[model samples]
Target: MPAEKPSHFGASARRLVGRLAPYRMYIAISVALTIGGVVLSTLGPKILGRATDYVFAGLIGRNLPAGATVEEVVAGLRAQGKDTFADLVAGTPYLVPGQGIDFDALARVIMQVLALYLVAALLMWISVRLVNRISMWTVRDLRSDAEDQVHRLPLSYFDKQPRGEVLSRVTNDLDNVQQVLQQTFGQLLSAAVTVVAILAMMLWISPVLTIIAVLTIPVSVLVTVLIASRSQKLFKAQWAHTGTLNGQVEEAFTGHELVRVFGRREQVTARMREVNEELFDVTWRAQFISGVIMPAMFFIGNLGYVLVAVVGGLRVATGTLSLGSVQAFIQYSRQFTQPVTQVASMANQLQSGVASAERVFELLDEEPQVPDPVDTPPVSASRGRVEFEDVTFSYGPEPLIEDLSLVAEPGQTVAIVGPTGAGKTTLVNLIMRFYELDAGRITLDGRDITSMTRHDLRERIGMVLQDAWTFEGSIRDNIAYGRPGATDAEVHAAAQAAYVDRFVQHLPGGYDTVLDDEGSTVSVGEKQLITIARAFISQPSLLILDEATSSVDTRTELLVQEAMARLRTDRTSFVIAHRLSTIRDADLILVMEQGRIVEQGTHTGLLAAGGAYARLHAAQFRGAAVQVDAEKQAGEVPGAPG
Candidate 1:
């Protein structure tokens, strides 16, 4: 049974963050630099306050007692405004216009400001470097793990879902997580620490003023919290719709031939337009709602600043504060808002990041239907004997192959001929352990294939699938795919056996010619030959050919058939075909329909039996190549070159 899927994303996140704990030293360094950067920033305002106090002292030519308060200065000025204290403020002489300025004190303040700026810049540089390194490394680890999971997943998982949809999760969805890890995660960490530090500093400076300044904190925080919670769902929906849009585009492009043949181009385009519109609406709403965070923080923050100014100014007028202290308090008021706004904005980004993280985690959480067992025994080669005993299989809810039993001896060719959807391919999949049988045993050399590791079992079998894919590489490389370390001589020998050597020798680059995507530059028949050559190079104990000659010309088919004869001399072979003519010479033929074998015998025996095999053979191969040619000329099916 598969493991239960996780319901709470928070647990998954904590798990992911735990993986980062190994980088504690780097994280500490980054945090220290950020704190230094913030502290240096605070110094700028402190220096400005000192400069203000000095300028006032120089104008009056009176030295203030150490630790004097701005409120006392304000009270003295007010007293002078009233009576006996009037001459106190008036007696202070002002500096002559254009006279020498207080260069020494001004220079010291400027130098201190520059020093703070320099320290802030240096700390920021170090912090960014450490943070970015951690982020990039985390992304790399995540993507690699996701890709490994995809390769290990059961084939049935792919059968039930579109290729494009699965691909979008790895590509686009992971990219979203990468953006969060690389760009947003570090900022969130720094913002959080800075906000805490500022709030602590505000409370320390003056609890009364701090309380007044933070009057809007709860309201501002509540609003951002509400918005973030709502945007989480919206962002998740936006990502899902984006994936749907991408899947539609991929499907339309891959199946353009069908779309054009059926004249449904406009219909597909209209559907795509609708999908795009849905995605646009979802994205717009998510982003617009998220956008309100910063501005709301700013509104509350500015209101706090105004409140501080009013209260502090009155305290100074009442002789309770010093000019320098008022300046420092005002500066602190501005400083307090910055980290608050920073954290509020980060809440929005964090919501989006969490949404993407949930999607990525979903893929990680999927349980492969048939996981490779820890105690799986390794398999070695033997006389190629395969047996299926009462095997029953299904994609999921619908059973595709049921109560099937068959055997293939060493050095024999067994052909599976069936109507479409009659479980021919599924049989091969069962032998390869691509899908687990619902009920029954498939064995190789008297050992159950399920008891052996997938890698160990598959290593002994060679397959040339109906839809063979040729990766972008040189012709020689494609042929050598069956055995990675195969020499040039081995590659050439396989190519010669498959008759692909004839085409290779004629090309300008001979064996080095490049095969483009899906081998589109080569003819379909030639690509089939190359695929056969790749299988031949593997030299496995058993060979499975799934419609290997279906797309080739008559001359090409004969050549491949001759090669097939040599390749099958010591190995067991299972051939699947639809055209009937290709498998007439098999040692055994099984006619399958509706997931059951309706008839089984040799060509002459089945012909004498006059069963399902005879009926299909008579109708399909009455005139052999001539009937096929007629169908091709009439455009009923695609034709291969002679």
Candidate 2:
């Protein structure tokens, strides 16, 4: 299947952020702490420069030659009537003029710098903690919402898309969203805050140097935008190919036996290789294009750094800027460019995350199945009287069933026999309300089925399909699935009635034997019997058996037929069978052709009329007809009680 188009990036981003509304307090705190950390970090270079300035001033004020003593410098300052300045210098420990430094004063400045760094580190830790909490909480809610959405969607939706494609959205796409939130979101926020703080400090130091550094912004942005524009589409393609690849692997592995039986292993492998090659092609292009962003931004940043150094040095040499200020400006220029580069890299990651979010939101936004009416009544006392009047339905543009009508009264078995695509299963689906009719209505127990809640209506009916399904649990659990609260004795009795106990008793654990997924641990016939036992435990007022005994052996089929006779004794039943012998005694036989009932009567009545049903019967039981003829010639009757 082709990939679905992604949703608008702006809309997906807004919806993703809106998911953080519940944790807005944490988000606010994280923002504040990030600002505080960036501010403190930005002040470090200037404070260190101030300390350097103090040492410079001490040397110049003393007028010290290379090896002059602190006493001589003090004497010189006192002679100039600078007593306060002289005393302030004398108070410094280890204040030898040119031979030694002011160790005491320098230690105090170092301690202040260390204090700022410590506080900044603490703030960063707290901010990251908060962001992580918020991101994890939001992703958890997204996973839960996606899973619940799957259940609410109509069956038709699953019929249209591969199961693995939906699974990829729920698991793989959500994982991408989580990775971006945890890593990229925090980095992006810190980068933005750092950029603003660094630029402000740079301007304060020297507007000339600030302009030199600011010139790089537009160039870097243009490069990043150009590269990202091309990369975004590749990123979208990468994820789409990923979904397709996952679907291929799932399909191949699930049907491995079929592939081997049909000698199509080479074909399956070739198909998988084709999908894998497509995935590799898109993945490398996305990586290569987005990969250009970092290096391009770095080149622009280096250009700005060289310009700042040259301009600031000239101003310092001309006596317009102090050495300490020049030093601080250099540090600020580097800080300013670092965030720009970080932001550029983060932009690529953010685009990929947005692509994943688009897939997830597509599923979340699918229209759910139409709900029952608000004032719908509860199902009345059900006597299993089902009526379909002038019903019509279609799975596509062309209608499959038109003006179809049927009635199954209480305690009657309606056997539906037809060729393939005769709308037999479609009719059952309409009766159970699995698919809504295009027009007309179906009634159960004299009440319009549409007027009653679907849950209430389906609860009173039990279905056993041709392909039986069992979950990964003990055999006992599979049998008791329809009624979870069924007693162990009830489970055993139902199993015995369906003849499942015949094989189950021979297993090592008896009823407690575990079945793997798909119930492949047991034979197909055994699986069908287990489903029959499940329906028996439900004790439904209405029953549907669609080729329920087709997989069983002759002896087992006879046992199941006896059980069916007892099961339909006092309840309404709809039986769809290809074999004409199974439903010979049905109270009403419906022969369908091209989605319409061409004949309706007892089996003998239909055969005597020689209509569609009679032709089907002859086609299926040609040998039986010849045997009846031979028995009649031998003076023996066929179909007589032994």
Q: Best lDDT goes to which candidate?
A: 2
**lDDT, candidate 2, 523-578, per-residue tens:** 99999999999999999999999989988998889899999999888899999988
Q: Rate the local accuracy (lDDT) of all candidates.
A: 0.77, 0.85
lDDT of 1 by residue, 119-196 (tens): 898997889889888876776777887898888788766766667767777888777766766666667676666666
Give RMSD to native, each candidate.
5.3, 6.3
Model 1 bad stretches (over 4 Å):
1-16, 60-102, 375-378, 623-642
- Give the TM-score comparing model 2 with the true structure, all chains together: 0.88
lDDT of 2: 0.85
TM-score of 1: 0.89
Which 10 consecutive residues of model 2 have the lowest summed lDDT?
633-642
RMSD of 2: 6.3
